[model samples]
Structures are given as C-alpha cells and as structure tokens.
Target: MDVEKLTKALQWRGFTVERFATAAEAADWMDQAIDGVSVGFGGCLTAEQMGLYPRLSAHNRCFWHWQGDSRDDASRSDVYITSVNALAETGELINIDGTGNRVGATLWGPKEVYFVVGRNKVAPDFDAALWRARNVAAPKNAQRLKRKTPCAVRGDRCYDCKSPERICRGLVVLWEKPTAFEKMTVVLIDEDLGL
Candidate 1:
C-alpha cells in the first residue's frame, strides 16, 4: 500500500492521520493518548485484536455493546473508537452497520472519533472500498456472527440477501472528516488486523 499517498489524501480530506509500524505500537499509543476519559467502542474486530478494550479500560471508563453494555450508554461517552470495513486510499471510509449505532456514534455524539484501520482494510478508491466493505468484510462478519444470510452460508461474497438476520443493513461512507466532531483521527496500521 502507498502509505504516503493515503496519508496525504486523508489529510486533504481534513482527517488527522497517524501511521504505525505494528498494531501493538498503535494500541500502546491509543492507551496513553486516551487516558482519563470515557471511551466508547463500536463493534470492531480490529480493536479486539489490539486488545484495546482491556488496555483502554485500565485508564478510561470503556463501554461496548459486545460486553453487554447498551448502545445508549456508549453514546454518552467522551470518545468513540471503531474500525471501518474498508478505507479508500483516495480518502474515504466505508462501513456497514446492522443497528446504525456505530455509524451514528462516528457521525455525532462523541467529542472525538478514532478509526483504527489495518492495511487490509485499505483500497485503491471509493468504489473498491465499497466493494471490499460488501464483498469482503460483510461476508466474513456475517459468517463470524453465524448469520443466516446467503453471504455467510456461501462463505464467499455478498449476495445482498434480504434475510432477517442480515447485518449489513446500513452503509456509511465518510468522504471527509465530519465538521461537527471536535476531533477525528485515523490510525493506519501496517498489520492486517481484522475483516
């Protein structure tokens, strides 16, 4: 991946970009940077890989629906952290959410929003990013959740099925940093951390 180009593009779109050599370094930085605050997390496999919840929870009040916490509880947090399904090297972030709580939190409510993206999540352009989000990330996530969707059963790509268990109900594309958010940071990791 052209890290320099991606970083420039993201910065041009008004996002602060931080590049890391490894997920461990990124996680360590996150742990120290977000100290003494209320941090909320969206359902992110990348964060889990980095062990962010336990690390961040050491110094911050951390909440996540994955831990049986309510989305409403997380919404009131001081900072929100999550990972996107796909990131366009041309400066776009794509995510598919079942409930919209994750996307909604990224858009508003939190004082700061941090996206912890892995190299595998980066695509060449917006279209490719969207495709990755649907075909790559969504299917894997569906399979992981044991959803009855065609994508999960097939264990291949997205069929855009209308199953009630479908998790890809909402699509969000962030082409630029949200003005309403007090701060937005994108941490680019070299390792392939998640789906």
Candidate 2:
C-alpha cells in the first residue's frame, strides 16, 4: 500500500495518522503519550497482540472486557482504543461487529479514540476494504470464535447467514471523523497483527 497516499487521504478526512515501523515502537510511544487517565479498550485483537492491556494498565486506570471488565464502564472512559476490521487506503474505516460494543464506542463514547491498525488490515480502496471486512476479517474472526456459521465452517466468503451466532451482524463505516469527537488517531504499524 502507498503510505503517503493513505496518510493524505486519512488526513483529508480529519484523522490524525501516525505511521510506525513496528508495533513495539508504537506501543512504547503510546504508553509514554498516555498516562494517568481512564482508558477503555474495545474488543480489539490488535491491542491484545500489542500487549496493551498489561502495558497501559500499569499507568492508567484501564478496563477491557477481555479481562472481565464491564463493557459499560470501559465504554465511558476518557480514551478509547480499538482496531478496524478493514481500513481503506482511500480513507474509509470499516468494522463488522456482532454486539456493537466495539463499533458503538467509536461512534459515540470517549473524547479520544485510537485505532491501532496493522499493515495487513489496509486495503487498496473503499470497496476492497469493505469486501475484506466482510469476507476475510469476519470469517477469520468467526472461525477463531468457533461460530457455527457457513463462512466460519467453510473458511471462505461470507454467507450472510442468519445463524444465531453470526458475528457480522452489524457494520460501521467511518468515512470521516465525527464532529462530536474531540480526537481520533490512527496508528499504522508496518507489521501484521490480529485476524
């Protein structure tokens, strides 16, 4: 992907884009940038892969559902951290969520939202990004969660199944930064991370 083009596109959409050579560099920078605050975490494999929970929790009052923290409490923190299912190089952010907890917080919750994205999550264009989110990311996540959906079972395209365990029930696309939010930063890591 063209990092320069992607950065310009995202910037035009009012997002702060920060590129990193590695996840470790980004994680260390974030740990130093954020401190002594209430930090919330969405259901993000990228953050988990970065070991953000343990690292940030040491200095910040952090909450994550993965660690038995209440979702409601985590959603109301001073800062929110999550990852998108697929990010368009043209500037669109796509996320397919089941319970809406992850996408919901991005829309309306914390004043500052951080999207920790890896190089693998970037797509060439908006349509490609949406397709990646639906087919690749969703199916992989479903398979990981052991959901009984066709996509998960076959490990292929989305069946758009009506299965009760369907995880791609809701979709969120951020074309630009919402006016209500104070800040939104996209941390682009060169390494592959998450599903």
Candidate 3:
C-alpha cells in the first residue's frame, strides 16, 4: 500500500498531513505537540501499539478517559488523537465504537483532532471502506467486546441483523473537508495499527 498517496488524499480533504517513517518519529512529533495541549485518547489499538499511553502519561499532561475508565477526563485535553479501523482512498474514516465516546469526541469535542492510520487502513474507495468496516472492523470489534451480535459468536463477518447488541449503528463517514482548528493532522504510517 502506498501510504503517501493515501496521506495526500487525506490532505486533499482538508486535513493537515504528516507522514512518519518510524514509530519514534511519530511519537516524537506527538510529544512536541502535546506541550500546553490538553490531550484526549480514544480506545485505539494503534495508540497502544505505538505506546502512546505511557508516552503521554510520562509527559505529565492530563488524559481523558473515553470509556468511563479510571484515566478518562472529558473536561480537558486541547486535542484528541485516535486511530480508525479503516479509511477510504476518497478520504473517509470508519470506526466502530461500543460506548460512542470515541465517535462522540471525533464529532465534536477537542479543539483539534488527529487520526493515526497505517497503509493497511486504506480501502479502494468509499464503498469498499464501508464494506471493510462492516466485514472486517465491526465483526472483530464485536468479538472483542463480547457482544451478542451474530457475527460476534460466529467469529466472522457481519450479518447486519437487528440485534440489540449491534455495534455498527453509529457509523460516521467524513466525506467533506474538515475545518481547520489549531491543527487537524493525519499521521500516515507504513506499519499496521489497529484492526
């Protein structure tokens, strides 16, 4: 996957684009940006994979808990950085959230928003991206959350049933350009992050 192309696409959609070759570069950039910035983190596997939790904590800045966890603080954090399960080449982001905290924050919360994504996160197009979200990200997340959805128990693709435990209801696709805040950056990496 040519991550550079995807990064460009994201930029074309009005997102500040930053490309990093290694995890150190990405974390370093984030560390500098965190100065005087209240930071919010989503329950993203990529953030964990990049060791962002300890990095942020070591910096002594406030952290917000998205899942009512011990570390979340909704009132603070100047910015929020999270990982999406998949993004489309057309510049749409897809993520499945259990408690809607991640999506809610993404919609409107932090002054600035950042999406850290890998090359594998890009789909062929918008339709493919949504399809990947259902068949790939949603089912996997359902299983992880131990939801009672059909796909969760089957341990496979989504059945798209009317199950009350459906975790795919709050699907959001950002097709338009994002408004610029202090900074809305998208960090594109070659390594896979989440899902």
Top of the candidates by TM-score: 2
lDDT of 3 at 86: 78
Backbone collisions counted per model: 0, 0, 6
TM-score of every candidate? 0.98, 0.99, 0.87
List clashing residue pairs in candidate 2.
none
Which sections of candidate 3 miss by over 4 Å? 64-72
Global fold similarity of model 2 (TM-score): 0.99
What would the per-residue lDDT of candidate 2 be over residues 1-195, giving only the tens digit for each residue? 999999999999999999899999999989998899999999999999999999999999999999999999888999999999999999999999999888999999898999999999999999999999999999999999999999999998999999999998789999999997998999999999987
Candidate 3: worst 10 consecutive residues by lDDT?
Answer: 67-76
Residue 86 of model 2, lDDT score: 94
Error of 1 at 55 (Å): 0.9
Pick by TM-score: 2 or 3, better one:
2
RMSD (Å) of each candidate, 1 decimal: 0.7, 0.6, 2.4
lDDT of 1 by residue, 1-195 (tens): 889999999999999999899999999899889989998899999999999999999889999999888898787799999999999989998999998999999888999999999999999999999999999999999999998899998988999888999998899999898898888999999999899
Error of 3 at 59 (Å): 2.4
Report clash pairs, candidate 3: 38-77, 38-78, 64-72, 64-73, 65-72, 65-73
